[model samples]
Target: MPRHQLRLDASSPTIIVPITARDVTELDQSAAASAAAPAGAAAEWRVDLFTPFTDGGGGDPAQAVAALERLAGLLPNTPILATFRTTAEGGSAEIAADSYAALIDALAASGLAAAVDVEYRHPQADRAIAAAHRHGVPVVASNHDFDATPPTEEIVARLEAMETAGADVAKIAVMPRSAADVVTLLDATERRYRQARIPLITMSMGALGAVTRIGGGAFGSAATFATVGAASAPGQLPADGVRAALDLLHRGR
Candidate 1:
């Protein structure tokens, strides 16, 4: 397989386009469309959106691996960040904590994805982080607050917690209720960025927070999500537009 790692320290933030296909056929189509993303952009496989995983509780680990292989074949040049978000975190699927950790362990060991996202608050989060590290795969430990943005101190604490858990990257996304909320999220991001040992990904979701998706790098966000065909989250802009904005905002920095 081709080797491509997602980097957050680039002059411009890494533009990650979500691939939200539900099946192999749809995955093929989505993978093709993702090629239209900016030249250096990466693809995030929203594995929870895949029907096989959503059919019952959690899908077969073998099936998930097979699907990942197919995606890797389809987009050899694009780095893939595998994310099997659960319903509790505004995702489509629901899985037991043990099952969730096992899936992450399997995915990390498979070496198909450039990085794997593990929810920070999951009961077995530490287990998943350790397993992923044993395989030399970076883990993007993440937390999402779809309700509202937390206080700046709380946001920074969560990021620090992820780092302490041995994650290679720390990510958090929060829904902003007002313009001030967006600023709060940004301030937290910059604060964590200044002290963080690993890369950080932070965003304030929704229309009021859309600016973060385009120019969050200025405030220390290492990466931002964008849409290729279907959006996996609120306020995700078109990948091409996000890429251009990131370049413009971070130019000459």
Candidate 2:
């Protein structure tokens, strides 16, 4: 299948709508919704939430590949970011490091996904990243903190680390306990954005940090995840709403 990966734009971040489903039926519905998203939008298949991969990551590789093929067909025009988020990083699935690396390798080789999300902290993360690149699939090396936001320098270091690890794009999401934490996340984003070679995706999740979803582009984030139906993460405004806000903020640029 021809890949139509969404190109990230720092001055005007692209909107990514996440699709989470537990079964094929729900997958169909969610995919349809994501497919119907406005132009310039992309879809993130939250594979961890899917039933096949929920059983301790013991899901069959062939079945997973087949499902992704079906999903690709459904969203033919939309770029798909295949992600199997692990429980250690605020995800629902729990799989061994080797299995995780193998799964990512398979997805990267399938030619069905425009990109794949690799957990930067996973034990086999380096192996997974190398495999994905070997297959010519761009890797979005990501880290998520659900408890609290790390210091600005720590966040910046993580993003830089992802770049050093050969990721095509670097992403980080953090939970904020106060308004200042949100600033810290964005501050780190800007500091990194000013010097980084690859695109960046950073956001402070939750109600207190919702502004990042709308205005992160100004801080140099390349994309922001939104929602068409069920959100994969917190503080995710609806796709249309986020798009409008982004346009308004970057208008006349």
> What lDDT does the true structure give each of the candidates?
0.89, 0.90
* RMSD value for candidate 2: 1.2
Tell me how candidate 1 scores on lDDT.
Answer: 0.89
Mind giving the per-residue lDDT tens digits that candidate 2 earns over 1-253?
Answer: 3276659989879899998988899989998888778678988998888887786547766777788989999988888999999889988877777888888988888988989999998999999999888888999999999999999999999999999998999999999999999999999999999989999999999999999998999999999999999999999999988888888899998
Measured by TM-score, how close is model 1 to the native structure? 0.97
**Candidate 1 per-residue C-alpha lDDT over 44-121 given as tens digits, one digit per residue, 9 for 90 to 100:** 998898988889856887888899999999998889999999888899998888888888888888878899999989
Single out the weakest 10-residue window by summed lDDT for candidate 2.
55-64
Q: Please report, as a residue range, the 10-residue window in candidate 1 with the lowest summed lDDT.
A: 1-10
Model 2 CA deviation exceeding 4 Å by range: none
